[model samples]
Structure formats: structure tokens, C-alpha cells
Target: MKWMEFSVHTAQEAVEPISNILHESGASGVVIEDSNDLVREWNGAEDEIFELSQEDYPDDGVLVKAYFPLNSFLKETVEEVKQSINDLLQHNIDVGRNEVTLTEVHEEDWAQAWKKYYKPVKVSNFITIAPSWENYQAAADDELVIELDPGMAFGTGTHPSTVLCLQLLEKLIKGGEYVIDVGTGSGILAIAAAKLGAKKVEALDVDETAVESARSNSSYNHTEAAVTVRQNNLLENTKMKADVIAANILADIILRMVDEAYERLNTNGCFITSGIIASKKDEVKKALLQSGFAIVEEQMIDDWVALVAQKK
Candidate 1:
């Protein structure tokens, strides 16, 4: 099979929104190549090391890449993608150069190449995300491991936004509480919640591919019995109440769903949100407050910020 590689040159601030745009355009998986990774410090478990090369990254800005199966409508899809990326500027996002290029390649060329870069990443004190291909052992008796393929999904559960969300989950989950992971992506958070002793987890995503990937990851992690993957759009038409709701998605989307999340959360239940760039943090915080949530905690890693809010 052949795939079209869509690559974008953009600023760090634009990475999240641009990546979201690519995912919404039917990309199987997204790859981010930020130049900062070359010099960034590795704070993983003591034994973990990332061997990165200067040649593999952009010199000035971040490169966001995604793959789409070659199809007749690809040309149109590419055009739409470009337009959507440009539209990010309307949200006050810095898109940098916003240059886009497409290359055709065989599936075999990239299907396994990216795996070498993904290893067991200790995203939080209690949780580590390991690729299904790697044999990762828990370093401590209390450490929880989430095995994921990510396949063509959005993330491997190691992104900063995801890490922040997972950390908040670890701090908030007290076992046997119902949790809902909106825009679950690869189902990392839902699985984490289950592993952390959530009695039940509802992993929701609007994309069928994401829904399937989440289900597969949950089953692989042996959390299927407690984690239910569903194709739903940000709590729309859902009636189940949750003790906690986690959403690691674009801040704009998070704003759109704030009311829904607030409504679905039980008394004193927390709403954990990430995928917010620093510039948009205040906007999200205000929305959460207006929705009757009292901001309880906030954490920032690099340019991403995650917030934990409790229902008043």
C-alpha cells in the first residue's frame, strides 16, 4: 500500500492546533519533529536514553507530519488541510512559515521506522507508556505500565499534554471512581484510569479510527473489562455521570465542551484538561470558571498547560 506524507513547517505554538487539523483530515497517524528535542533534557527513568540526531529534525521550527492512504480524493483533502492550517491564525495562533509539502512513499518505508524513536517513557510518577513492541518492566511495585501501539492514532501517550493529564489522573483518582476520557485518542488516559483502579472508564472519541485504536490499546493493556471505548463527540448525548473527566485536546475544543463536561461530572468531581498552549490557557480557565467549575490546580510543562477543576 502507498501513503501520502503531509508535512508542515510551523512554530512550536502551532503544533497542537495544526496537528489536530491534520488528524481531523483523516490522517492515520501524526508525527511531530521539533528541533528542540535535540537539546532537551531527558528526565525519564534513570536507564532511559533517547538517541536523537540533528539531521532528523528541522533547523528552525517544528515539522508536523501525518500519513494518509493514497486515494482519489487525496488531492482535495490536501487542499482542505492547508486551508485549515492557515485558519489557525484566526485563533491568534502563530503558524510560522505554514509551508506544506507532500511526498508519496510505500507503507513499508515508514510503518516501522518511527518505532525506534518511541521507547518506554515514564510520563508520571506512577505511569509509563511503553510501545507494545518493547519489553518494559515496571521499575517499582507501584508503577503502572500502559502498552500502546498508537498505530495510526494521535499519540503514544507521551506528549506533554498527555503526560500532564496522566499526572493529574494519578493525583485525583482514588480507585473505584467512574472516569470519562474525552477525545481519548489511543485510549491512554482511560487505560491509566482503569489501571489506577477506576471502577469503570468510558473512553470516547469522535473518530472511528481513534475509537478502534483506543479499544485495541485498552484490550492489550488488559483494561478492557473496565475501559469501554466508544465513538462519541465530547459527551454529546451522553447521560452517564463521572467522578472525573479528562480531555487532552485543543483548547478551543475544550472550551466548546466545557459545559457538557461540567454537566457530566458529579459533585466535587474534577475536570482535567490539557492540549492547551500557553497563550490559550487563560481562555480555557475562564471558560471552566464560567461553567461553574472552580479551578483547583494548574501545571505547565514547556509551553503546554493542564488544569484540574472541581465542580462547585
Candidate 2:
């Protein structure tokens, strides 16, 4: 089979949103090449350390790449992706150069290109994300490993927004609590909640591919019994109540569902939100507050911010 590599040259702030745009366009996988990775500090895990060539990255900005099966609709999909990314600017997101290019590649080459960049890394004190192909052992007795084949979706759980969500889940989940993961790409957070002893977890995604990927990842982690993946658009008209509701999506989407999130959560329940750029941090916080949530904690990594808010 043939694949079309859709690559974008943009600022670091645009990577997450553009990657999401590509994934929602039905791309089989996404790859991010950020120049900052060269000098970026890792958490110092032995397995996380690897040689990164300076040549594979852009000189000034980040390159976001995604693979789509070569088909007649490929051109149309690319246009839609470009438009969706351009829409990010309305939200005040910096898209940088926003240069896009497409290249043809064999299935084998595209598959091999992205795999070498993924490896096992602990995202939180208790949870670690390992690629499905890697044989990673827990360094501690309390470690919880989430094995994911991220080719199906845009999440590897290594992005700072995701890492922040994982860390908050580790600290908040006290076992046997019901959790709802909105926009559950790759089902990473739902899987982590289950591994952390959530009695039941419902992982929701609007994209069928993401729902399938989340299900696959949950099964791989043996959390399928506790984690359920379904196609839903951000808690719309859902009667399910959860002890905790987690969303690691763009801040705009987060705001759209804030009221529903608060309503669907049980009394004194927690709402964990990530994928918020620092510039939009105050806007999101104000919305959560107006929705009757008291901001309890905030965590930041680089230009991204995550907040933990609670119902009174």
C-alpha cells in the first residue's frame, strides 16, 4: 500500500492542535519533529535517553507529520486539514510558518519512520507509557505500564499536556472511583485510571478511529474490563455520572463542555483539563469558575497548562 506523508512546518505552540487536526482527518498516524527535542531535558529515565540527530528536525520551528492512505480523496483531506489548522488562528493560536507539503511513500517506509521515535517513558510517578513494540519492564513495584500502538491516534501520552493529566490522575484517583475520559485519544488516560484502580471508566471520543484505538490500547493493557471506549462528542446529553472527569483537548473545546462536565460529575467531583496553551489559560479558568468549579490546582509544562478544578 502507498501512503501520503502530510507534513507541516509550524511553531511549537501549534504542534498539538495541528496534530489533532490531522488525526481527526483520518490519518493513520502522526509524528512530531520539534527542534527543542535536541536540548530538551528528559525526566532522566534510563530507557528514555536516546540519540536524536539534529538533521531530522526543523531548524527554527516544529514539523508535524501524519500518514494517510493514498486514495483519490487524499487531496481533499489535505485541504480540510489545512483549513482546520488555519481555524486555530481564530482561537489565538500561533501557527508560525504554517507551510504544508505532501510526499508519497511506501507503507514500509512510513511505518518505519515514526516507530524509531517512540520509546517507553514514565509520565507520572505511577504510570509509564511504552510503545506496543517495545519490551519495557517496570523499574519499580508500583509502576503501571500503558502499552499503546499510537499509530491509530495522535496521543502517545508523552506530550506535556498529557503528562500533566496523567500526573493529576495519579494523584487524584484513590481507587474504585468512577472516571470519565473525554476526547480519550489512544485511551491513555482512561487506561491509566483503570490501572490506578478506578472501578469503571468510560472513554469517549467523537472519532471512530480514536475510539477503536482507545479500545485496542485498553485491551492491550488488560484494562478492557474496567475501561469502556465509545464514540461520543464531549459528554453531550450523557446521563453518566463520574467521580472524576478528565479532558485533554484544546481549551476551546474544553470551554464548550465545561458546564456539561460539571453537571455530569458527582458532588465534590474533580474536573481535570489539559491541552491549554498558556495564553488561553485565564479564559479557560474563568469559564470553569463561572460553571461553579473552584480551581484547586494548576500545573504547567513549557507553554501548556493543566488545571484541576472541583465542584463545591
Candidate 3:
């Protein structure tokens, strides 16, 4: 199906509010460009990395996205959203929030057309992701594994959240320990843990696409992680305890699920939650504390936050 593409460029700061308006009005996807105004096409990577879309970025934080349904009330929504954009433009704001770009996608497959862009990506010292369309080679001398392919849910390891998770996974995961990955998009975190030598891994996602994608990727890793991919909200399918729990989910979800995370922990085990907004860190911390966890450390990259907590 064809789509109407909208490229709304404004001071990066206004991107988020504009995106909220567009999404509320019904946008399938929104791309928020970086400070450098780069909405990257990591060459075949796809997935919603966080609750925040490109519309949430600032300073050249442009929204370039399209939604299928050419004959919908897209024009009315665009015009209505433009009023908000213009109000921002009328104000003296940061550099990225001053301009707006809008356009329509006259033709192209709005569905399943992103597959051609998926390719192999190297994330860490011994890890690489190869989609089903690509091939991966591991040197015998090198400790390498983390084979994955594109899926509908998220986490091909190219996204900021996934990248952050992989970075932390590289630092935290050691050999022969139980690991649990909540919101296991494409099984990226689970696959990373398995590659890092987790004795057993439990990967779960509410989305069926994510479950299937993760299972397919695990097969490619050849390391054979005992992964249980399920369609529950969080930790609903697993009664098995864990030494580590990784959650790359939205702030609200993290706060709501902190108790479950603490309940499933194996004393002193780490709970790593990313995909939090810098603004919501305090609330998440409070939730963690209420759930009997102490903040071990907190890290931020751009607007995203990664909190490392330990069970008491």
C-alpha cells in the first residue's frame, strides 16, 4: 500500500510534542533525527527502540515518517499539527526546533519493505548480528556469537536502546549464570547474554513477532541458549529464578514492572532497565526502591537512561 510521507523539521526541542500530536492523530511511524539531523537507516534495521520517537528529539530533530492510507484525513491532521509547529517556530527556541518539513509518500510499499535494509552489524568484542538475508563468519580463534535477523518488534542491536543494552551486557555478563531478558526484542539482549556465556537465558516479549524473531536468532548463534520466549506482559511465563534481568522498556512500563523484577531476582542479582527518559529517572528509582532494589548505578546517553539496580 502507498503512504503519505510527512517530513516535519523543527527545532529539535519541539520534535517530541509534535510527534505526540501526530501519533495521537494516527501516524504509523515517526523518525526523529539526531542533532546532526540523521535519521539513520542502519542499512536494514527496524524497530521502535524506545517509547520516544524522532518527534521527541531536539535541535534539527526532524520528523520524517509515513503512514499507509493515502486517502485518510492526513491533510487535516497535518494542518492541525502544523499550528503547533508554527507556535513553536514563532518563539525563540533552540536551533533544532525552528523549522518544519512536510511531504507525502506518493508510492512505495509501506509494509514489509524495510527488510532489504537489514544487514550484519558488529556490536562488541566477540558479537555480530546477521539477519537471515546476510551471512556471518566467526573465526575459530575469536570468541564470537550473536546471530540475529530483523523482526517486527525491535532490537536488532542497531538501535540506541539495544546498543546500550549490548554495551552493558558486555560489561556485566560472565560465564555460567542465569540471565533473564524482559522485553526481549528480536532476542537481542538474550542473545547477547548467551553469547556472553550465560549458563541459561530466559527471553520474553509480549509481541509474538519478537518471540519468533528471537527464537530464529538463537538458532543462528549456535550457542543454544535455553530461551523461553513467551507472550506475557513481563515475567509471567517464568517461575525460574535469575541472576540478572535486563529490561529495555519504556519508563512507565519499567516503573510498573519493577516489583516483578525484584520478585524474580536471585539475591543480589542485577536488574538493568534502559529505555527510560532522563526526566523519568526519579520515578523509576522510586519504583525500584519500593520493589526492594537499590540503585547500583545510572547511565545516560542523549535522552535515554540506563539504570542498574541490585536486589536487596
Superposed on all Cα atoms, the candidates' RMSDs to the truth, in angstroms, are 1.7, 1.7, 7.2
* Residue pairs with backbone overlap in model 1: 28-152
lDDT of each: 0.88, 0.88, 0.65
Arrange candidates by lDDT, highest first: which order? 1, 2, 3
Q: What 10-residue stretch in candidate 3 is worst by lDDT? A: 43-52
True-vs-predicted CA distance for residue 127, candidate 1, Å: 0.9
Off by over 4 Å in 1: none
Give each model a TM-score. 0.94, 0.94, 0.69
Model 2 regions more than 4 Å off:
none
* Global CA lDDT computed for model 2: 0.88
Candidate 2 residues 1-312, lDDT tens each? 999899899987898888877876888888888887777666646655677788888997889988899989988998899999999888788999999999999988977877777878767777878898888888889988888897635666788888899999999999989999999988999999999999999999998888988988899899999998999989986777899999999888998999999999999999999999899899999999999999999999878899999999
Model 1 vs. true fold: TM: 0.94
Among all windows of 10 consecutive residues in model 2, the one with the lowest summed lDDT is: 40-49
Residue 221 in model 2: lDDT: 92
Q: Quantify how close model 2 is to the true structure by its C-alpha RMSD in Å.
A: 1.7
How well is each residue in 34-106 modelled by candidate 3, as lDDT tens digits? Answer: 5432444232224311222444444444443435256667677778766765664453333353445555553
